[model samples]
Target: MKEVKAFAPATVANVACGFDILGFAVDSPGDEIEMKLVDKPGIVIKDITGDEGRLSRDPRDNTATVSVYQFLERIGAEKAGIEVVLHKKMPFGSGLGSSSASTVAGAFAVNALFDNPLTTEELLPFAMEGERVACGAAHADNVAPALYGGFVLVRSYDPLDVVRLNVPEELCCAVVHPHIEVSTKDARNILRGEIPLVDAVRQWGNVGGLIAGLEQENYDLIGRSLQDVIVEPIRSMLIPGFDEVKRAAIYAGSMGTAISGSGPSVFSLCRGMDKAERIAKAKVEAFKSIGIESDMFVSKVNKVGPKIIY
Candidate 1:
């Protein structure tokens, strides 16, 4: 095929206790990328939509094009020309893995168009490079799930070992994005450089419990494991009504609630779609009580990561 299009779903990074390590994808609100092979011998970003002109068209700067560029360079196909068009369906800085979705879409589309020189997991390094271009750090929590789908655990980053985890069928996600911007850099800067050993022990247990809960399909254990002792306490202060929102979600039958990635967006695990929707509404109302507008999404875990659209 001369051209191809792909879509990648938004992801929830961190997943509470597994900071910078765990993530899962959601069904709605994703990014799309269209890539067309050309004779120009260079990557060109022809268009970007739904970004409100905020995204860079330069291939080196934009996540979508940069991902494609990196993939081609890695494959020694830098001399091959490609044109990319990105559709940012989701909001930026929403802590919903916006850049990851775009980056995955671009990388997936180009790889498919090129007849799959790399496997889905093999495309991860290029996608991570795209993230590094977007932010200063190359984090795989968001990109891993967005590319691999379902739940993923970044077991180690040295050799870049990522493991896809089991997802409970009844587990649902409710995400609420308050209509406020949370700078990822600023949110990260506010975190404690070091924590007490007691907190570290608690966090390690919670992470282990979360993994077991997911594998065993134990919702109650999952609820108990959603506590964050290290990052949430500090970063949550940036999000207004965070405590109230969490309380509201739990009251609305949510298993647990935590800040999605950095701030502004909060996520909860629920038993089913009904509970997920209720939690979403409750979180929205909680934000409303604080005079903050918000956007909400309720979805079962997305098992399919990225799809070829054309």
Candidate 2:
């Protein structure tokens, strides 16, 4: 095949206690890319849509094209001509893993166009490179889940060890993106360079509990584990109405709620879709009360990550 189209789902990163290490995919608000092989010997980003011209088109600069370019280079196909068209259907800087979704789509599409030369797992590093370009850090929490689906745990970044975790069948997610922007860089920077040993101990226990809770399908444990002692206390200050939204979601039956990745978007996990929907509405109303507009999404955990669109 000379052409291929692919899609990758949006993701909620950090997952409360598992900051920079855990994430899960959602069903909607994803990104897509159409790629075609050509006789010309380089990468070309023919067009980008849904970003209001905010994203870069240069193959070396854009996350999507940069991922594809690096993939081609690794497979000794750098001389091969490829054209890409990225469609960003999600909100950028809303903590929904927008850049990761686009990068995964481009890498997944280009690999498919070449007849599946690389497995999904093998394409991860290339996608992470795109993240490095987008955020100055090649963190895998978002990209891993967006590429592999379901819940993911980044056990080690140096060795690039990643594990896909078990998600309860009834697990559902509610996300609300308030009309505001939070720079991931700024969020990370705001974190104190050092923390008390007591806080670190509490954070570690929560992370371990979260992983075990997911593996055991224990909803109560999951809810208890969704507390962030270090990051949220700091990063959440950047988002308006953060505490009110969290309280509203909890009152509406959310198992737990926290900043999705960096800020602006808050996410909650519930036992069922009904509760997820109610949580979404509650958060939206909470933000509205503060004179802030927001968008909401409710979905079960996406088990399938990127897929062929055409």
Segments in model 2 whose C-alpha atoms lie over 4 Å from true places: none
lDDT of 2 by residue, 95-136 (tens): 999999999998999989988899989999999999999999
Listed per candidate, the RMSD to the true structure in angstroms reads 1.0, 0.9
What are the TM-scores, per candidate, against the unseen true structure? 0.98, 0.98
Candidate 1 TM-score, true structure as reference: 0.98
Poorest 10 consecutive residues of model 2 by lDDT? Answer: 69-78
Output the worst ten-in-a-row residue range by lDDT, candidate 1: 65-74
lDDT of 1 by residue, 44-83 (tens): 8999999999998888999987888888877888899888
For every model shown, the clashing-pair count is: 0, 0
Report the CA-based lDDT of candidate 1 relative to the real structure: 0.92
How much is the lDDT of residue 18 in candidate 1? 93
